[model samples]
Target: MRMVFRWYGEGNDTVTLRQIKQIPGVEGIVWALHDVPAGEEWPMDKIAAYKELADTYGLHLEVVESVNVHEDIKLGLPTRERYIDNYKKTIEKLASVGVKVVCYNFMPVFDWVRTDMHKELADGSTALFLEKAKIEAMDPRELVRAIAGNPDFTMPGWEPERLARLSELFDAYREVTEDDLRDNLRYFLEQIIPTAERCGIRMAIHPDDPPYSVFGLPRVVKHAADLRAILGFADSTANGITLCSGSLGVRQGNDIPAMAREFAGRIPFAHLRNVRVYENGDFIETSHRAEDGTVDMCGIVQALHETGFGGYARPDHGRHIWEEQCRPGYGLYDRALGIMYLWGIWDSLGRGKQTKREAFSV
Candidate 1:
């Protein structure tokens, strides 16, 4: 596994490249232009600016976290063709920059849903939490307010324009069953996978956050079977999944390590992290360490190592560790800790020569 860190551009992220370089085993950054709205062509100049920054630190810009799919595409609106054209152009632009993997998601309005952002954990650190029971009973207006209340950070799934009419969005999606969603995704991949393959970039689709249907909206990429079905839609290496443990592991019965081994041939990228699941379907993000969280980080890493996961991997969401007043889950302290934990496991597998500490020393 080639280790990477997620840096939200220059001024966008509180974590700096200098600080990211301090993390052991990290050789690159999982980056993107967060300000660029979905379906718009990514400017080559903007991509190059980040490339120069990474070059300065001797790091590669090999993976991008997301190139968000527009809602029109998912809804199968009349304007979808236009958006898909834009997405194809964006893919071409990204490929020109030598980016090997593009991680994107197809979930509706909210990419991922969390009941509370500051849910306190046993380790005295706070993290994103999902109380399943509460979500089931939540009113749409209240849900909108909870999501919008946090003006300090822009929530990935809850875009301002979409959230403005939650009811309309929800109503429009009521007819979009699982099968319809899958068909739409298939249509999308049929059009774009060829470009991705030609450009030598693998398109890894992120699993729905929380891995379930929310607010009566259908979510197609919720489980392993869902991923399998979607991958089969376009039998190209370019069409792949961005296997995130925290997202897929939240649902009971998803063997995350097994996914790494079974989908090894197709998977080009992964997000490694853990979430502690509780009774009544509730779960909270935890340290990426295996022992601390529900997911088996060690076994998963070993599986990837055994499968020869040559694609990019990065530490996913992290807790608010050590009084770091940073973005709720994007704090440097816990994610740095996560990178060390991941490296320790990957190193123990015997393929690695240098310890993370030594490897990180530029």
Candidate 2:
């Protein structure tokens, strides 16, 4: 696996490229033009600048965390074709600068939901938390206000412009059932996957955060069957999935290791993190250690190794530790720790495989 780190950009992120360069085994940065809104073409100059900055740090800009899909495309509105064309252009631009994979999601209204951005853990550090009962009881508008209230950094999905018309968006999506959402996603993939293939960029859809519907919004990319169906929508290597352990692990039934093995060939990107699931359908992001969370970090890495995965991977959200006072989940300290833990497992597994091959050869 090729280790990558997510860097917001020059001024947007507290973690500098210099710091990222110091992290062992990290060879690239998963990035995007965050200032640009969805359904718009990314400025080539901006993309080039990002590439230039990464090159300065001796890092590759190959995997982009997201170039968000327009809500029109997800809603199947008449304007969706225009947005899809814009996405194609963006893909072409990114591919020109050597981007290999683009990670995005089709969750309507919200990309990822969390009841608390800094819910204190037993260890005194705070982590992103999802309280099912709180979510069910709170009005989505209020929830949006609460999530967007973070003064330190702007949350990706809770953009002010998007949340400003929350009621209208909810009303627009009221009739969009799960099946309808699936059809819309298929249409989107059919339109863009071919372009992605031509540009030598893989379009990897991130599974809906939490792997379930929230605030009555329809979510299509939440299960293994859902992932399989989407891959069937376009029978090309460009069509792929970004297997996120924390997101899919929230469901408990999603065998993350099995996904690493099953979708081995199609997966071009992965978000490796763990989550501690509670009995009441709630969860909190945890450390990368196997015992610290529910997911099998070792088995997942081993499965990727067995598949000979050469794709990009990164440590996802991390807890607030060492009084870092950074972004809610994107802090540098904990994620740096996560990288070491992941490298430990991945390197050990790789060494074991090499030893076996040498034994066979002898």
Candidate 3:
């Protein structure tokens, strides 16, 4: 398992690439051009600039978190073809800089939703919380306000540009169903997978945040079967899943470790964060450690090791600790701590060198 850190970008993030490089065992940063809107051709010069930045600290530039899919593409709109052309261009640009994996998601409207950004935990350290009652009863606009409350830090999924027209987006998607979303995703994969394979890039789609539908939105990437259906869309090594534990772990029924071993061959990127699931189907993102949340992070790592998942894995969202004020979930202190926790598991179980490509490939 190659450890990675998710850095927003220079100036946009409180944590710097320099600080990230100092973290032990972190081989790269999961990054993207946050300023760029989805489906636009990422300038080669801009891609080169970040690649150069990572090279300065001996970090690899290949493991970027997301290149978001436009709602048009997700809806199978006529304009989607234009956006797809642009996406193909962006993939080629990333290839020019040696990016191996690009993690993107197909969730409509809000990428991920939380009832509260800083739900107070018993330990005093706050975490990104989602209560069952709150999610089922509370308004999405309220959640939106809380997530974007910090004007300084732009939430990656909840972008101001796309979400500002919430009402319209909701109205448009109101008619769309889960099956519609799945069909559109299949359409997207058919077009993009070929381009991705040609560029030597793997497209790892992140599971829906919380691994469920929210605000009445249709979500297709929710469970193991969903992932299995998604991978079977293109039937290529370039099409895969990001396999985030915290997102899928919100539902108690998900067997994260088993899914890792089952999909090991296709999982090129992994988001290793844990969340404590309440009995009522709600959850809160906690530190990477086992005790902090319900997700069996150590067992997940053991499965990764057992399956020889020699790919990029990074600590996902973490709680805010030490009174440190930054992005709601992307704080530095706890995430760095999360990295070491992942390291502890990997060091004990991550025996032998990184596995070669052919080992897990079918």
lDDT of 1 by residue, 176-291 (tens): 98888888899999999999999999999999988888888888997779989989999999999998999999988999999999899788988999999997889999998788
* Cα lDDT listed for each candidate: 0.86, 0.91, 0.87
lDDT, residue 294, model 3: 92
Error of 1 at 89 (Å): 0.5
Clash pairs, candidate 2, are none
Please provide TM-scores, in order, for all candidate models, with all chains considered together.
0.95, 0.96, 0.94
**Lowest lDDT block of 10, candidate 1:** 353-362
Question: Which ranges in model 1 have alpha carbons more than 4 Å from their true place?
Answer: 351-362
What tens-digit string does per-residue lDDT give for candidate 2 at 1-362?
88999999987899999999888888999998888888899999999999999999889999997999889998999999899999999999999999999999999989999989899999999999999998888899888878888776878888788888889999999999999989999999999988999999999999999788788888888878999999999999999999999999999688888888889899999999999999889999999999999888888999998898989999999999999988889999999999999988987876735342221211
Whole-structure CA lDDT of model 1: 0.86
Ranking by TM-score: 2, 1, 3
